[model samples]
Target: MIYDQPKFLPGGDRYMLVEFGNEMNLELNFMGQSLAQAVADNDVKGVIETAPCFASTLIHYEPEDISFKDLQSEMASLIGTLGPSEDIELDSRLFYFPTVYCDPWTKEAVDDYRAKIAEKEPDPEFVARLNGLSDVDQFVRVHSGTEYWVASLGFWPGLPFMMALDPRCMLTAPKYNPPRTWTPQGTVGMGGASTCIYPVATPGGYQMFGRTPVPIWDTQKRFPQFENSICLFQPGDRVKFVPCELDVYELVEAQVADGSYQYNVVEYQKFSVRNYKAWVESLDTSARF
Candidate 1:
């Protein structure tokens, strides 16, 4: 797909922001990610690092080695050769996180919030109604049925903001009005138009729905999955939430406590945006839910 010219704005003396579009969509996100990869491939002088967001990329560079204008020109040149977002292929990994939906932990958290913060119905029921689903079970099915794309990692270390790969599975809900004071680590929540998995305990606004025993961030990097970094996710990776019973959740928690837990991951598949778009176009809206 053809996109409009990107807007390059001065973030500061050492940083620059390249915005592909103002809207949040896969096409813009893919372009941003593709540009980041292109910059890495070229290895342009003085360019320090690049952070790709939902629809923009932030580039850090040293002013001593290269002037801001020169670096901007270089980046524009690199972006020019990026061609089309749909043609970009990503080396993506697929991961499965065993989750217990509407579990005791999240239920308590939600109940606590409702008592202290807002007087409202249970979080699961609220989210389910907001998404046009009949009940919590149907909501869980819709959430876990489609693959979610890890658009970017932010808010806190290893926390991933995920977007549903299938449009039919996409659901939207408003964030908590005042935000939660503390969200349990491994809590799965949705805010605005995206879903996220909290890597650590932190304050948040996303509607909490489930809790996963699997660790998304390991500060010690004890497992093989976290060998490269403490963060277990990266842009372009895909995650599927597999609903589990309380017994299975406790079993995984025991394994995790003993450092014997192995993450279920598949690295065989490479994501192709062109093919993905085509597949999405072919699917009927009813099939998504």
Candidate 2:
């Protein structure tokens, strides 16, 4: 289980995706997440963010500041630490809030967005009709309540893809079709034993169950921001979505606005030139950023 020489990445001029391969194996997932945290925890210079996917972890950084070879070396050295017994899971737990998802789109609204790619890929009408995904057996189980982990963070600031789900809850691909574009913000989804929600939606394709008002992103970070500043989910954390009441939702939103609210555990998009610009500007203005 060691990549002795460590896989070096092309790092396209500035960013790099250190691939572990496209295996959703639990071991790979754990390794990828652990390495990411180690890099971030060590505070690697020039490392802006690390995003872990099925089998790869992408690191966003300034190559001009730190050479690829050096970063790779750091990553290789980092693989030495990880797993359930290695660190404190981020105590991910539950925090409930309110969401209003009623296919909000009328036939007219659907037609308007139809030409756009966003309208085409939707949670299959059949899936919605049958409430299909919900019926999948609880695919995973846990010995006890453990906090979730922040596998990696990127895509959107504060938006950290998290971990910790009973296989029972883990979702497989296409028992049903998923929405093309979820609410700009209010989606809770579980992917392969990992449950997460887009703090603020832009465009994604994941199973949706409920919504919450946990403000994971802050738009004020940059003009024309894409729900900027997604409140990131970190590792060694526990998460739970609180079932919210209207009054609670309102109160939570206010708390988020004021920067005082919290969550037990909570946690994509294509982009145009404009989208890219917003992303760059929205980054935290400190460090090698």
Candidate 3:
């Protein structure tokens, strides 16, 4: 739930955690991102950087430059300037990713996890059944029908924690019981209304469904998009997964291997919270793509 006022809490000596709400929703995220931008635009003194999460922003500051009390005061003032969530407009990039749904890689991983750790249903079928979808085909259609918002990056370097932007596509699943020993790189998975793409093979809990050949993180900076940061996504970026066949996935993989693949991106778009709210209001929540 959203708090009546923002809570400013201390994070050690050099960090400040400003929480907008306890629940995970886009409205709270807008407030967090707005405050982060306000800090940068207002040139808040002693602030090193701000990391905005789903419902809060973690502020890194220099104690020698600004005292905790004074920093709180400055941040409070900035929060006041942010106005309301509906009035917020932010620069957001849209990325198109080619994803292979119900892929063999994630299936094999799930099978191995069940054999080694615990016995459970297949990831895709389990999620589909839990969500009341007819089958995996419908599940894939619903999941890929809408764009996902990158709410934050966590757990792994460059790993994105995202939420479905369209209300119709919203789906939830339980994570693995003991957690998988490893997940394939670029695997797309979902848990608790959030979707994520694995940046690298690592221990994971989300129910996996798809795999993308395009790299979301490249330490070598092979692509032009990685010029500024090794991570491909920021908090406000959006992702649209395009379902593809194994042959297409392999083709893109080959292109990526030679550093010849180009990322499909729309960089000039600005996300308007007001417009989004209006669209959501007009939609039938019971409907699915």
Please give the distance, in angstroms, between residue 65's alpha carbon in candidate 2 and its true position after superposition. 5.4
TM-score order, best first, reads: 3, 1, 2
Q: In lDDT terms, how accurate is model 1? A: 0.88
Lowest summed lDDT window (length 10), candidate 1: 1-10
Model 2 weakest 10-residue run by lDDT: 135-144
* Every model: Cα RMSD to truth: 2.5, 12.9, 2.3
Expressed as tens digits, the lDDT of each residue in 1-289 for candidate 3 is 9998899999999999999998777998888878888999988889999988889999999999999999999988888777777777889999999999999999999989888899999989999999999999999999999999999888899999998999999999988788888999999999888899999999999999999999999899999999999999888899999999999999999999999999999999999999999999999999977
Residue pairs with backbone overlap in model 3: none
Q: In order, what lDDT does every prediction score?
A: 0.88, 0.50, 0.92
User: Pairing residues by index, what is the TM-score of model 1?
Assistant: 0.89
Residue runs of model 2 more than 4 Å from their true location after superposition = 1-6, 25-30, 40-49, 52-55, 61-67, 81-94, 97-150, 174-182, 190-195, 207-209, 218-232, 242-289
- TM accuracy, model 3: 0.89
Error of 1 at 263 (Å): 1.5
Number of the predicted model whose lDDT against the real structure is largest: 3
Q: What is the Å distance of residue 163 in model 3 from its true position?
A: 1.4
The sequence of per-residue lDDT tens digits that candidate 2 reaches over residues 86-151 is: 233333334333442322322233334455544443332323333233321211111112234445
Whole-model alpha-carbon lDDT for candidate 2: 0.50
Better of 1 and 3 by TM-score: 3
